[model samples]
Target: MPSSSTQRNPWRYLRDADVLHAAVVTLLAVVLSAGIVWLGYVVHVWRIARRAPTTLRGRWVVLVFGRQLVADAPGADYRGRLARALALLREKTAGRVLLLGGRSGGARSEAEAGHAWLQGQGLPADAHVELEQESVDSLENLRHARGLLQGGDRAEVLPPVALLTSRYHLARCLLLARRLGFDGHAVAAEEGLPRTPRYLALLLMEATYLMWIDLGMRWARLIGHRRMAARIS
Candidate 1:
């Protein structure tokens, strides 16, 4: 027989009905808040997907963002992106083409490889192809490309720019381009590359980036840039 003090009533430990109701309400509130955040992210991704292939007119510069090379050669995804850029260049004879990418675990920069490849592809000799070989990411690519453009004699031209990249990557690229004061449009490369698990992962990663940028975390962006530079270096 247990002593009176040792006897435990499990019901006694349970909260009063009012208290349980309040706890349930709090839990529901938290879950609702979480659901709202998840919904917002879903909407953001939907908008990005919808806007990925939107084209803008006027004098446009072709800005091709770079991806990592596989054994010093552009991977299938990057090859598709480059092929699209090349197609745009062939179709639009007015604007200059800028190949933007930096060295990442390679003997040569991505821009260098792109320049060489485009040259070999019979790009017209009169076409002005500029190489930006020092940008490690999308933001850096546009920022550096902007600097290059401003440094040129055509600084005052202020043409609407066309970004060539994977469809999943175009939204964030366009966001950064607008932040850098570019009147930009996207020309996505959705074909050739299979929609694999890696592609889904890339989409999630890009969504996180868009969220971070939207949150205006300057320090986070700086740290991310440093980390990328360290990885490539």
Candidate 2:
């Protein structure tokens, strides 16, 4: 009589080397596909920055923030590009700029830097360049800037505003702008530095911060909505 002890277990066979190799390959494929999709989305956002609207009407304000101007300085190529873009905007909008941001180093605030840049370009003192000197990040920049604008009589009477930031940042910035009750368009400054290790590091940091800023914006909107509803009721 033949013993049945030699019968192979089906479960054990499934865990063999070839089967394991197949499973690993399948997982790698899925991961690679997901990476591709994410990259495509990033590219699309870049395009949005490059092609934002350039016009503002009688009732809207043109807001420009991020990276202060310095056309010639150390590790300041992005600031230079943004400055040039803002200069062009000033020409187009005829001095309707609402600059945001504060100092990066402990020396100055983002709003102060922005003010200095526009003033250097000969923007009048009354040219509508609002500042949020206390804001250290994008979320604070936008939130605080919006509050400053809304607190003014002109903002109450004018139409919604248009926000401008670097092109790659347009996606998240636009999201925050809208969430904060800005019923206006967002323009990408479309500025960049040469793709180098340092530049890439800056880009990565900016992207990571965008995610955190979005979280802050979510909470801001939730609270804003509740307050509005409470007032109505």
Candidate 3:
């Protein structure tokens, strides 16, 4: 009954409302799924941080993750991680310590700075320490470390390994180490993990990174990207 002059073309609209609604729903579903997965990672990190680190019996290697330097000196986080390593070494828990990190816009590489700090703190006369000063990131740090450990044998066949890093960093470190087949335990730099604001902020950032790596690796494996999968290996 509509008059010809009153007729309208549906195509006149720039977009269909139904299509927009479906797009929004799809986007929401993806976001919700991602958040759920990310939350799982957060919970995983929290569990590790709150638990007591496994005590190595003897002759274990403590992989001390490198932190950023503050004004050419070890920052608080850096010192905290190093201090934990020092304590472990003094207790004879770990026979060797491997400091990992490269030059990150500083006068010296993180490992080198850590080595110097260890010296200033007076390392054990018989202590055997190695510095991995070429890895600019955590993945590279762990990869290079595995190579150093491997030599000719695989990393999993080596002695027990402990990943020592900041409380906020333990989760990522452990994840990477395990992915790299290190079978490593986590040692938190700061004693008694508390749910502080700053710590939670750090966790959020770490969670994002954790999720990024997890999803990336998953997608890579899903797509049969052997080289990418092998890199995560």
Candidate 4:
């Protein structure tokens, strides 16, 4: 049986109050940290959006990122992006185009499908067009494209690049392009479908991806610095 003194102890109450206060402070700290991270992410996205170039000029290569095709045909989003790319290709006569995407849901790769579509659209025979069908994602697309550009005769002179993607995806594409060391601009295509819950979900997913990439790059730099320091020491 517990004593009444023990049950009514003011010191016990004080101790519990202290613990509750500490817990609340810790929770608040975590929330504040999360808020700060979220704010930073928003600012990063905003900056990328602001920096997305409106005009593409010079000896630029149009990089059309691939989307999933159904029944070997480009879906509405992909069609919209392809249409924009076609328009750009027609307008920018001197600029070449590169279709970037991987095989999905069929034997034909996205890049291959894009090229075929453009040919079907009666693109000029002399227009410089390239296909990078091996990439699995946006990062891989840029990396592979860089390799293609820097390989062989073009190694000495890498041309500037312009990305054509959906409006929501353009910022992340530009971010990836910059990380891959390309003088890049972005041309955002109009969203083919109306804004739905899926669109918001995709935007959130992109934001998460951007955060992941930023963290990965920072980690790589830190690791590289440590390795260099170790070698020097």
Better of 1 and 4 by TM-score: 4
> Which lDDT values do the candidates have, in the order given?
0.67, 0.52, 0.76, 0.67
Candidate 2 per-residue C-alpha lDDT over 106-155 given as tens digits, one digit per residue, 9 for 90 to 100: 35554556566556667654455566555545556667666676675434
Q: Which candidate is the best by TM-score?
A: 3
Question: What order do you get sorting by TM-score, best first?
Answer: 3, 4, 1, 2
In candidate 3, residue 83 scores what lDDT?
85
The TM-scores, one per candidate, come to: 0.70, 0.58, 0.81, 0.72
lDDT of 3 by residue, 1-233 (tens): 21233222324232744333333443454497966766787888777778846355666789999877777678988998888888888889878899998776667778888989988998888788999887767888888898888886673476568899888888888878889888788888887886779989988778766766666566656777676567566
After the best TM-score superposition of candidate 1, give how far the Cα of residue 208 lies from its true spot, in angstroms: 0.9
Model 4 weakest 10-residue run by lDDT: 1-10
Q: Which residue pairs clash in candidate 4?
A: none
* Candidate 3 wrongly placed segments (more than 4 Å): 1-34, 152-156
Model 3 quality (TM-score): 0.81
lDDT (Cα, tens digit) per residue for candidate 1, span 161-183: 88888877887888788777788
Could you tell me the TM-score of candidate 1? 0.70
lDDT of 4 by residue, 77-132 (tens): 78777877777767773377888887764667788888888878878767788888
Displacement of residue 232 (Cα, Å) in model 4 is 24
